[model samples]
Target: MNRKHFLSSFIAAATVLPTFKTLANTVESESSSFKIPPYLKQGDTIGITSPAGYITLEQIQPAVLQMQSWGFAIKIGDTIGKRDFTYGGTDEERLTDFQKMLDDPNIKAIMCARGGYGFVRIIDRLDFSTFQKNPKWIIGFSDITVLHCHLAKNYGIASIHSKMCNSFPDDWSKAELVQIETILSIKNALIGERMGYTAPAHPNNRQGKADGILVGGNLSIIETLAGSDSDLTTKNKILFIEDTGEYLYSVDRMLWNLKRSGKLKNLKGLIIGGFKVKPDDAGEEFGKTIYDIVSEKVKEYNYPVAFDFPVGHQRNNFALKCGANHTLTVSETGSVLQSF
Candidate 1:
C-alpha cells in the first residue's frame, strides 16, 4: 500500500483517490483456501498460554477451569507461569511458550489468555512450520488480531478470532446463544453455512452474493500492517473489522485508509463488528453513529455490507475466521455466513 494514498484519502474524508489501474498491479486472491480447524470435542486437550500480556497465575486457573468444564483437557504453556509487568515476560519467553503450544501435537487448540500488545515484537521470530504442517485452531481477539493475520496469511491456515483467556469469560446473554453456537462451530466449520442478522441495509447492497476468504481483525492492527507482508489483500473477499478505544473520527480515517489503499475497492462484502466503545456522555460527535459512518463511506460501493453480527469489542464476541473460504449473504431480515 502507498502511505501517500492513505494521507490523501484521510484528508478528503471521502472516496477521492487514484484508480487501481494507476497502481497497475494485481494480487490474486487465493481460491483454494484451507479448512478451519475442527472444534474441540470431548477429550481434546486445549492449551492455555499468555502470549501477548501478563496474566496472574491466580486468575489464570479460572480460565483454565472454564475450558476444562467445556470438556477440554487443559495444559498451561511454560511462560504462562512467568510475568513482567503486563506481559508474560521477555519477548523470547512469550515466543517460546507460544511456539511450544503451537508445536505440540497433544494440544488440539492454542488459546491465548489475553491480548494487550506484545506479539508484534516477536511475530517474525516465531517458527510456525509445525503448525502449518499440523494446523489447529488458534483463538483470541483484540490485540491478538496480530496472530490471526500472521497465522492465516503466512501459513494459509485457519484461526479463530474470538474471546481470549480471562478470569471472567464472556457469559452468554439471554438472546445470544444461537449466535454463540454458530461462532463456536467455526472451530469445526462445516461448509455451506448460513448466518444473517437484522440490520438497516445500505441502498448500495447490490442484493447479490460474493465469495472470498474471510479476513480482518482489530482496525488498529489491520492498519499497522498496511504495507507489510502480513498486510492482507482484500480483493475478491469479505472483510470483517472491529475495534475499541478509537474515536468515531479515527474509525472513519482507517476506513478511508483502507479505501485509498485498494483494500476496499474489490471487496465482495464488508462486515462491521462493534467499534471500540469508549466512556461518553450524551452527545453525538460525528452526528452519525459508527454504523452511519461506515455505511455512508462504504455505501458508494455495490457489494453487500452487513453490520453488527455479534463480533469484536462486544461482550459476546463470536469466533471469526481470518483466511478461510466463506460466503456472505445479506437481506432485510438479517445476514447469513456460509463457511466452506
Candidate 2:
C-alpha cells in the first residue's frame, strides 16, 4: 500500500515482460529460418542411393559418368542393384545407405537413384540428428518429394526437386536439347549458380508478380503428407506442384485437399507444372481438365498462377531449390521464376 513499494514492483514487472517478449521472438526466428547447404566444388563427392525404387548399378552408370565429367567424385551406395520386390532393397538397407551418406562429411550431396514407392517406409526410422548439424543437398523428384517436404517442414533446409539417375540418357550425344539442358540444371544448382526459368505463356495463367520462399513437389505426395510431420507449410510461399499418371478426378481431389488444408490460401504465387493424367475408364469419365480443377480451387485467391512450368515426370523437369527464396512473375508474354 506504500507508493515506493508499488513503484518498485511496477518497474520489476515491466523489465521482465520485455525480456520474455524478446526471448519469444528469438525462438520464432530460429524455428522458421531456412538453411542452404554448402555448394559443391571440384573434387567434391556426391553419394548416389536408391531410397525409393530399384535400379541396377548399370542403370546409374550414365549418370555417374556424366557427373564425373563435371569434376566431382561419385560414391555409389549399397542399395544400387538391390531389389526387394518393387523397392530398392529391404527398408533397412536403404535407410542405412542413406544414413551413412548423411553422416559422411566428404559426401557433399545425395542423389536418390530413382522414384517409385518407398521413402515413407523409412522416413521415420532414419535419424536426422547428424544431418541437421551437417546439411547436404538432396536431389530427386516424384517419390523423393517425401524427403523434400520432410526437410522443409522439420529443418527448414533446401533440397533439389529434379530428375534422378533413371532419367539420364545412356548416350548424351544423341539426347535432345531439352533433356541436356534439364540435366545440366542439376549441376548448376549443386554448384550454387543462380537459377532462372521461363515457361511459354498459357491462356490459363493469371498475370502478376510476387516474391517468397519456394516450396512444393509432386502433388500426390503432398496430399499424402497432410497432417503428418512432413506436411508442407505454404503460407506466404510460392508453391509449384506436378504429378503424373493420376486420373483427372484424383488430381481434383488432391487440389481440394490442399484448399481445405489452407495450403492454397495465403500463397505468394502458384505454379502448375506438368500433370500426366491417365485416361478415364471406358464408361466413367471425370469431366475436368487440369486447368479447370486448379482454377476452381484457387479462384478466390489474388496471387499469380502459372501453368505448364517445366517440371515433373517429363524430360523437361528442371531442378528446383525447395525452401529457398525466389521471385515469380507471370505476364502475358510468359512466366519467369528466378532463384536468389
- For each candidate in the order shown, give its overall lDDT on alpha carbons: 0.67, 0.86
Distance from true position, residue 21, model 2, in Å? 18
Positional deviation of residue 107's Cα in model 2 after best superposition, in angstroms: 0.4
Clashes of each: 14, 0
What alpha-carbon RMSD in Å does predicted model 1 have with respect to the real structure? 10.5
Which pairs clash inside model 2?
none
TM-score of each: 0.79, 0.91
After superposing candidate 2 on the true structure, give the runs of residues whose Cα lies further than 4 Å from its correct spot.
1-31
Q: lDDT by residue for model 2 over 223-312, one digit each (tens)? A: 999988778888888999999999999999999999999989999999999999999999889888999999999999999999998889
Worst 10 contiguous positions by lDDT, candidate 2:
7-16
In angstroms, the error of model 1 at 12 is 48
